[model samples]
Target: MLSLLPQRILRLLEFIGFSGNRRFGLSQLREGASNHSLRSILCAFTLLFYNTYVSLILGTGEGNLAEAEALLEPYQEKYPKGSIILFYSARITSLRGNLEKARARYEECISSQQEWKQIHHLCYWELMWNHSFQQEWQQAYRYADLLCRESRWSKAIYVYQKAAILSMMSAEELERTGEDLGALFRQVEGLKQRLAGKSIPMEKFAVRKSRRYKASNPVPLVIPALEMMYVWNGFSIVGKRADLTESLLVTIEKVEQQLQNDPNPTEYHPDDSCLVQMLKGLCLKYLGRFLQAELCFSEVLSSEGRIRYDHYLVPFTLYELGLLQKQQGDFIKATTYIERAKTNYKDYSMESRLHFRIHAALNSLKGSPVSTP
Candidate 1:
């Protein structure tokens, strides 16, 4: 959790108290996981969760997949149809960019048990993202709709996600669903709730985004689902496949052309275009078109001052540029750019999420080996 703190706060903590050591913590967990105790499974689970999900989402995308597999091997053998093991197996596969296999595994997990609707909720979430990573908006929307109706995890997030996925569909496709997109977005704010006296960051982000639809004649969000995809580090998962990355680029470019051709652009036009350019940069970077990716990122940075609502774009783009630099094996420049992003920005949408990624990136640059997309 110390990794989540700002640098200045971390420094203050060090002066007042000795911070917990990650390596030591991991060592203890490993010891507990190896022992034949009641909580051994819990220890193993903590490790598996960190290695499989947390590392990829909060840190760099270099999750220890092999280690996660090793940890789950025993559990899988003992309970071949265990929902949790099957779910982790699916997640590991998804992280490796095997969307089809992951989808099958998630379905298997869901079918393995009926006593736990919460487990089904977890699988639904993965299924939603798996379909999303494949750009199957209808199938994705199906899962999101299920989550909205069935899961009580966070209605605000689920409803907003449902609306965002619908935003990706064509008018006829959306019409067939008979759901009002604006109404769904309007539900987001009221459904939002505080957890443990603090608002959830992603929920708040979703609520703020949904606020746009509150105005009369609201300007439609451009690729809001894809934007949330980036927020959740979904691009890193999709980047594992050249075909997927290239397909995403094609979608972004088409949208870019449409935005460019608009005669009377709204005030949010620059922000929307910059959002597209950032997504394009990520796709290009994953496709090994580093020069083109850099140009896309630079374009976003150059237009930083003009971005109206998405102030987060500038710092996040800097973070992306840092990752691109690291991919090119330029550690010095990578650290410089990432540091600037971490220190120079605050109070933006998803700031906490970006800080987690920034922390992960710096750690990877310092010692951890990062896999290139």
Candidate 2:
């Protein structure tokens, strides 16, 4: 785990007389996982967690899915209906872009056992994202609501996610549900809590965003849930399914038009427009419209001076633009953009998360074998 820390964080740790070896750490975990010992499952879980979740979220989406699956195979055979096994299996499938299969497995995992409702809560979170990937807003909202009402983990994030999902709903659909959007967003800050003497980065971001809803006439967040999706790297997973990516592009374009037509523009209009462009660029990149995607990304950077609240957008967009360049086999140019994102930005929302990604991307460029065939 220490070895997985971002490069800058590791440098700080080194100054304090601490260091970590990624290879040695992975080897020890692998040995433990391969042994038939009492803690073998725990060892396997650590590896699986790193490969399936950590690498994707923090890294460059270059997770070793094959290794994760192989590590789970025997344990899955031994405990066919184990809740934990099912949960990880579902996660692996989800990461592989098998959303429907992953969704069914998550349901099975939830129903497999009732002794640990926390496991069910985990399923709820995955189910919410799975539904969101398909643009199934109503289904997604149900799981988000469940997490808000029952889960003890990060009520602020849950509540914010619930409001964000509702923001995606059509006006008539939102009205039918009778949910006050602004009220839900307004609840985010009061629900936030600190952990280990530090505020959670994402919760802080949510609270900052919820400020928009504090006004008497609140300007709604533009596709807030989809924005959250980008934060969580959901686009990479959804990008595997062309239909899903195209659907997301359609939704983004519709919102883009709505933003353009708003006669009463606020200070946030430029920020909102850039946000939409960044997301649109991701969709375009995945859909193989490289020229169009690059244009969208360039537009965000070009409008940087006009952005007010969402300063993070510029750096994050640079990171995305770098990845887009990487996808097109421009390694040197990709490195330059990604390096700029890492070094040129500071004190932004999710700054640490972006650093993690930059670290992984640099590692990948240096020929790290993060993927499996």
Candidate 3:
């Protein structure tokens, strides 16, 4: 709390070259947490926020789970049933790919709080993703539906996510939701909100995606829940579990086979097929089937001229291709593909998110610093 500063002041400091100081930040937090004052818990809260949430969002999703667990350990023992502690513990476990434990902890957190419904909303969000990682689309949709109907955090996201999860379901499962995906998507544009007089990038992305369903003969999207999962970088967490990645591959393969057997092709045929291939590539990459993954990504690039809608696919495929090469220790090839993806793309869905990933990959590459592309 003591270290908290206004955004304008912080920006000014950064502009003058007094950049963020992790050591200084940690020192102030440690001192504040140790003090015998009413503000001590607030200080602890700040530290927990950084470790459990901020770090994961800003950097590669491979977070310091050990550090986060350690920070929450004392609090866990001290406050056995504390809602806040349980929440962070669950989040850490989730990041570490311990879905069962995370779900249990989140449930405990929900049961531990009743006065603040916001806490329940948070747990619901976590539980939703836990089911998503497990490929339980119906269960995931239930929580997303709850958020859409109940939480005020982000109507645009909750509604789109609720729709996307339904997109993953079989016809019968989708019917059980009793909601039209197209109607839900049409609601996305109106639900979008602006932050600082500009539409939130993620909301804009969702709005653009919802547009696909706006056409008269709308083509159904392929595994949209997993696509959104990639957008939010959920793949990083899912990658830690072989079972999760395998299940995802299985889903993608089923979709691939269905597309193969289609007798009548639509105008969006190439685009939708390529989207599935890209997602399948990601799953293959995660499962260490690098050669097959490379083939899938290459096919997307190969189909560039045939794509009618969703112009964002190519650059994203490039980014995924770069990551695939990087995993194979081809730093030179990796840097080339990633740089092209960063430079060649503009105004695409989740552009900033891709940039963050590209920047991280480039920085991790050995030798010369990566160019801003």
* TM-score-based ranking: 2, 1, 3
> Number of the top candidate by TM-score?
2
Report model 1's TM-score to 2 decimal places. Answer: 0.95
User: Candidate 2 residues 1-373, lDDT tens each?
Assistant: 7766788789899899988787888899999999999878889999999998888888878888999999999989999999999999999999999999999999999999998999999999999999999999999999999999999899999999999999989899999888998889999999989989999999999999999999988888889999999999999899999999999999999999989999999989999999999999999999999999999999999998999999999999999888887888887778889999988889989998888888888867776233322
Residue 268 in model 2: shift from native, Å?
Answer: 0.8
Cα lDDT, all candidates: 0.90, 0.91, 0.82
The local distance difference test score of model 3 is 0.82
Residue-by-residue lDDT tens digits, candidate 1, 1-373? 4644555667788898857456777888889999999989999999998888787778877888888898899999999999998999999999999999999999999999999999999999999999998889999999999999999999999999999999999999999999999999999999988989999998999998898999998989999989989988899999999998888888899999999999999999999999999999999999999999999999999999899899999999999999999989877778989999998989998888788888778867876344433
The window of 10 residues in a row where model 3 has the poorest summed lDDT is 1-10
Tell me the spans in candidate 2 whose CA falls farther than 4 Å from its real position: 367-373
TM-score to native of every candidate shown:
0.95, 0.96, 0.87
What lDDT score goes with residue 167 in model 3? Answer: 92
In candidate 2, which residue pairs get closer than 3 Å at backbone N, Cα or C atoms, i.e. clash?
none
- What ranges in model 3 sit over 4 Å off? 1-51, 366-373
Q: Candidate 3: which pairs clash?
A: 342-373, 343-373
Q: What's the count of clashing pairs in each model shown?
A: 0, 0, 2
